[model samples]
Target: MTLHQQTTRRQFLQGTAAATAGLLVPFASRSFAFQSPNERPVFATIGLRNQGWGITNKSFKFADFAAFADVDANVLGENLEKAAQRQGKKPDGYKDYRKILDRDDIDAVMIATPDHWHTKIAVEAMLAGKDVYCEKPLTLTIDEGKLIEETVDKTGRVFQVGTMQRTESGQRFLQAVALIKNGRIGKVKKVTCGINGMQASPVIPEVKTPEGLDYDFWLGPAPKVAYRALPEMREGYGGGVPLYSNCHYSFRNWHEYSGGKLTDWGAHHVDIACWAIGASDTGPSRVTPLDYTLPVEYKEGYPVVDDQYNAATQFNIQVDMPNDIEMIITSEGDNGILFEGTEGRFFVNRGKITGKPVEDLESNPLPGGAIEEVYGGPVSENHTANFIDAMNSRKQPISDVWSHNRMLEICHLSNIAMRLGRAVNWDPAKREIVGDSQANTFLSREYRKGFEIDM
Candidate 1:
């Protein structure tokens, strides 16, 4: 029940620098402040609204709740009240998330904060010896992905990205991956991912920060802006259109905190595409944005308009994968993947999977127990449960950092290419945009002072 002192980055490296892969032994290798023979792992969540509690609700089945942190104090109090009522335990509340990371009793953390905050908290959590289940669009930029991937290796923490499409019910995405890997679609030639475009945003006036919300802390690494009250204008996707600075759910439509739909939905669809084409740890050799239209005027890849949404609304991007497979990612069609090969083609989304190969599954089906194979073993009850299993055994989760980083890197490159409105050669091994200095700059951003990730 007691919280430990925050571990300095130097202390973390000093503790872990000597540990090597040959000496590592999974769950047995790490030290925990509370690890009795049979007790469930303890967890804390940093972001307490929407997806934060949504993930914690599922995590209760696998781990005990110890603490909750949020910049917004009201949500923290509310979520803790719900935690007490649901779990019969009162969790400590933290306004700054670092306090949660300092807890030695907690074994894991769920980082459902905005995209920009994902890497900082996840890296620090692992550095403090907590396993992490970070929500999707794992990195705000390509640089963060590398940092996280390296830290996972250095710390040996079980990390899972919130890409649920990898483990959806009936194993639909697994089937797609399995079909492609098994040559069900002979020699993949092209792929099309039609995730919706960034929705339009009208001019929003800057206003006062809400009383209980910690707007500055919520902004974290993002550039600071005066808090604005965003109107609930549209329904479903891209609504609320919160200040392009720090968004509630509308962050996905902005580039400052996210990659718009490119990294929003692309994180899922493009991830599957990467898995299908066997390019999880590697990336494309070239990324060229075709016809593109930004929602706002731009110079040097930043928005000129202060209040209008700045992400591209129309884009047809061409990415050349390592395996001679070319993918066209666009903002059109039925929000799904259409895989084409020399032999045949099929389309799949959350609703259904279809085409000759999928139809052939009825007569000439995939091998017995194939879905589990694509799931990287047993089909879990859900992604959270899968992460818990990995935490116990020290195995890599289904949606892992290395692969997710590759997928995310591709998405980041697509945005950079689109913003530049030109073809950009990529050197995935180097993790750089080759040749173009301006293009290279987009690979990462300058973190606001005091909010930078301590490598």
Candidate 2:
């Protein structure tokens, strides 16, 4: 099928960039250091819901689960039970992740909190001398990305963003990057990142906070608002969740908690595009929101209706990359990355990487070590394994924070422009949005008292 035609074939699973179960380490390929018998890296998992549970589950084979942290006491208890069943032991539990950070055994943490909490938890975890495996998007704002980068530099902790596509042992994404890097695609020109559109949430009325849930802590960093009943919390694009912890999975739909599809899937595809084009340490020169649709009435980047979701409903954004190449991120078609170079173009997603460059592998394969090289060095069994292995060896993980932040910068910039409905220039070196004061305002958000990430 043509690239455009494939967009409609699969509805695409959101956030999960790759399949987890089929991920197995090549018997000869798990790069682990020789540590003493008791030296397996111990880990804590904060945000014990969906993604949190998944990351922690995947990493347990390589690491020791020492604790569980979450605002919901019920979820925390449930996660502790799962951990006990998985590991034959249950570690400590805490409502405040800060207590987890305080523990002597938490060598690292898998931060799967909502987007608003990703930055603060990551920053403090590094400061506390704990390595971190944080799920994707990395930041709620551009400034948060910088703070995490700085913390990584100063703390020397192994910080890995959960963009597992980079370390796929199958090399689906790696092969695609290798094709572009080997100059097989000719001169790179543009990338079309067809991410899914934003979700619309219904207007929900305020209600009493659910029991066994720490609502105040759950709203950490973001503005304080009433519990908008369970309905307002769940994205209107889909049917409601059984529990009111709608912020756990549905948080991606609202700007206050996340950047909708821009940071959601864009974090995965845009990141691969950056890696392919050799721009992971920098970002686009300009970001322009060519067109957009908002779910509710918008004014000054926020929706007038407080009860409904505010993130963009749909958008076509154009970004000018470093080498005069263009990037088109749209919510119109498929959820995948299409790389177009001078010689040819190709498409890749969770399913398959296809096109001429990929087909060329039949006769003229990638240079012997191209896949390994694209993966930085030797690939890990999985994204979490990379972080745990890196913790012992002190090397950057496959999806290291620096490059993830660079890719995250692109995601944040895309959201900024879409929110403003205009073009904004970005200075990657200085890491600032230029000229427009209002546009620059988006580089950071005001935090709730005592919730700021100390840079």
Candidate 3:
């Protein structure tokens, strides 16, 4: 199976049709050369340490794994070896993702870097005429979310945010949403969102940078900080004290990288909450962060994780949307949604949707066609498969940048409100914070010189 040079559009469309029709469409086959039908949809991956590996591996048969990038040389070497074994050829490796975008041969990129790098790399990739599959929490800031949406429109590049939940049947999640949409809950009144507490990253002394790792590049747009090897000392979540690193996933604590449990997990649940309630197109008009009882001796600063994470360890954020529906997005209890309506109350998470409305789950009472419209319709194909389909279809994947960017902004707003400990008013149509200079400032961060996410 050599590269089918000069294949017609008709052939590509036919192949896509077959694949969509449930046939085994080969994305890449060993019999095919590096130039086969599979290779026609070229793809590269950056940040191939953990999630990147799985995302890249799934693209194995359908795309040519032509290039890989990571700031950590160790991660780069590992990914390169695995990609070579899978593709039957070595791929170009680099530390800077912008260089990967510079390659004319590559048509798409999978970005599995930390939450911070997603926006900058994706904007650049689109500008360079490459489609992008970026990880969730799509932007580090609400402003970056808007910038990404603008860039996607400007570049006309297909982008899929790694919100694979859209692809999942998420039976319980869908069921809960369906229950609300079908009126089983009787004019949904409020959503009580309970997320698990974020653990703190206790202070750890700085350590020498690991060999072959470009620590600076890993920091990327983040301000220059001394390197620390202890897991708690690292930036981003998942670890020690509640504020030093915020909770687990420390970056979620810092304004620069993530929105702690709020955006980290909220992106998923809130997205579901909005979907279930038929409110995805519009978000809450107001976001107020509930105060927390922090331990004494708290110090505040940008990249607050610098000394220790300071993102909300446990707080409730109320987002008031249209229709008197108040979304209580929080980390106040067990992680999930509790829907309290005029008629009944129900809760749902990855595990279950329980309460008086269990009958709705039993009967599937949601509106039949409503789910598709809210979740962007059938474009929500299998995550990896959708990427390949977009490659050949030349169409936006279901979880495209503009759609998810809205969600990202909402998530960011919740964090900003919580961080500032104030109510932040949003003009969703205008996508701006209303008359609050300080709140607006939280919408974007000051990037390290030479590392700003470009327009």
Candidate 4:
């Protein structure tokens, strides 16, 4: 396969300027090459809620919106109009995402569905001969990650998880990785990832499904349950729906659909931590839940209550990573990562990268192309740009499935350990729980009838 030429440092800086100006320089333009509008890839987005619309919105620069799909008609229609306004043309809309997959015109599908729906849609999209760019926390379980990885290998499709920190976020994360690899931090000893906790909701009541929203379809592979909500609308970020409900933005709080903060913010911070420490392709040997608090009671690793949030409320997990590294994932402290090494320590997050090593950059800076070297080549203008470039080159993007799943396994194990109230030993090579048949059952969930993946 022929690879696209890596972007030069000057070109990357220029592309960054274009991104800041709200105009993405086309991938071809970065190489002093031009692509006509018709040459852009065709894309259709599934699950057009908060993050569904977000990834699609950024992708408008590299791909044309051919259609949009969502279980909520209101969300579908809203994003359709938004896409038309931004792209100067209205794409089609559908309640069934499968309809988008059936279309031959769409070269790729951007999946921003809830965690439960990610594997099904992504696997089907790949089998249907379409590339995929799915959101982070890519799987709800370890088994789902394995299935997705297998499907990607079988189809040879380009799959990019929406972990934008690897490409964007002011390149602070990239700089952090480069600093670590350059011996600025010496041999890494301990890394703490501070992914904040979720608030336990006061008993949400089972309520009538809203108009134009297909509640059943939203539930999908998860167990059938009454739509629960309180008559209060959430305000910012992923607002508009009931803030305490088991649907929409609050879906992350339910174990049936997502894995709370362990997978929510853990997907971002843990992914970066693993990459910086050269542990992306491996896994932790033991996941010990030093301390944790689940919002509801559980029996046999299953939540007892159905009306309230069931995922972990706060947690402090210690994972024994490769190379005798100590990794502490906790809900306490500021929301960021702290890398402590033999020589020095540094803290980094989306907002800033600080400490002695970062301060030393003024006198002794990272070598030219350091960030690109850490990124495996020139970084694209944005994550979506990297996806598009991969589509053209037939290469996997920065946040590939193999690495994403490896790091995500730690988050998944942390949740499992907390749910079972015991540390779970893992065999990374076998990808299974050791000596705990009962605990191993959580690796894969049984899908609800008629919603199972039809591989």
Top TM-score hit: 4
Considering TM-score, which of the candidate structures 3 and 4 is the better prediction for this target? Answer: 4
Error of 3 at 12 (Å): 9.6
Candidate 1 residues 1-455, lDDT tens each?
11321211111000112212211111111122223323566789989778898889977766678899998887889899999988898899999989888767787899999898998899998888888999999998888888898899899888999998886544577778888888988999999998888667777678777678888899989898776556445455433334343367766777888888899889999999999888888899999898888888888877877676778898899999977899999997888999999999999887778788888876777775555566665566668867766775678899999999999888899888878778999998898988899988887789899898765
Q: After TM-score superposition, what is the CA distance of residue 383 in candidate 1 from its true location, in Å? A: 0.4
Compared with the true structure, model 1 gives a TM-score of 0.89
Which pairs, if any, clash in model 1?
none
Taken over the whole model, the C-alpha lDDT of each candidate is: 0.79, 0.78, 0.67, 0.87
Q: List pairs with backbone clashes in candidate 2.
A: 200-236, 201-236
TM-scores, each model vs. reference? 0.89, 0.89, 0.82, 0.94
Clashes of each: 0, 2, 26, 0
lDDT of 4 at 428: 94
Write candidate 4's Cα lDDT for 147-252 as tens digits.
9999999999899999999988877888889889999989999999999987888998888999999999999999998999999889988887887898888999
| Ranked by lDDT, top first | 4, 1, 2, 3
The lDDT, on a scale of 0 to 1, for candidate 2 is 0.78
